[model samples]
Target: MKLIKYCLILALFSPLAARAQQPAAPAAQAPIVLRPGDMQVQARSAANRPDRAPVYPGGEQALGLFFLEHIKYPEAARVKQLSGMVVVTATVNVDGSVSNPQVTQSLSPECDAEARRVVSLLTGWQPAMRRSRPLAVLIQLPVPFGTAGHMTVDQARRQPQR
Candidate 1:
């Protein structure tokens, strides 16, 4: 009986002794912080090299037409003499909806607001594709605001932008 007790005690303590003999895991390191530009660069690369880029329901020409019809060179932007393009970075969701629209380049507050509004209004975009499945992709769009941009959507639709 004495031998059995000692053997059992040794068996139980053997594992503990082994564990104590091993070194402890190294202390966990702090997580790396991602800069704002890092995400933009990564997103741009992914969007540009996608298996298939997101498309408007009708295609590239349709996208051009869509912007033409929906974008209304804001009156405030016009009055403020705001020209040039407002570049908006957006995520075309897997369900063909836009989310996370952000002004990457500022033309003016009015122009930026107008650009966001137009992006918000857009729906049913064909989502990006990879391996025959839909994906979310970051895309940058330029909305022009000026007399130089004036044109009827119908006319523009007839002659799609290249």
Candidate 2:
């Protein structure tokens, strides 16, 4: 009976002991394969010109002023002293209209909603241009909400990333 017990204990622990004694296998390295034309540079064409980004109707200052006028501080944020920038991402359509505004960085629910509302209300955006053709683009607008004072676009831009 004692021999049987010892055999059972050995059987249970022998595999673990063997695994612990073995060194870890080295990682296999993948071979680098290169095909023809991999390093060849293509000639630049007029159609390959860099895309022009979308512009606001009144530019940055005017857009900032519009936000100052329209964005109302949320009572919840004010009560909680929640002061931070909410990053709102949206698509500027080929027609220069804003669409699909969403909160990418949220400070609070109330502040997020307010930021989305102000962004959606924006208009007169100049669509991006590629080779003189209008193109839609994604844009990130930072909206700041604070209880201390009204936040400006410059101030919002200066906020440290969380």
Give the top-scoring candidate (lDDT).
2
In candidate 1, position 46 carries an lDDT of 42
For model 1, residues 51-115, the per-residue Cα lDDT tens digits are 77898888767766777788877788777777687899999989999988999999888789888
Separately for all candidates shown, the number of backbone clashes (residues 3 or more apart, or on different chains) is: 0, 0
Q: List the residue pairs that clash in candidate 2.
A: none
Query: Candidate 2: where is the Cα deviation over 4 Å?
Result: 1-50, 147-162
- Candidate 1's error at 147, in angstroms? 3.3
Top-TM-score structure, candidate number = 2
**Against the unseen true structure, what C-alpha lDDT does each candidate score?**
0.81, 0.83
Report the lDDT tens digits of candidate 2 across residue range 1-162: 999999999999999999999998887878756678674333663563326789998898788788889989988887888887889999998888999999999988899999999999988898888878888788999886763235335556786433
Q: Give TM per candidate.
A: 0.58, 0.61
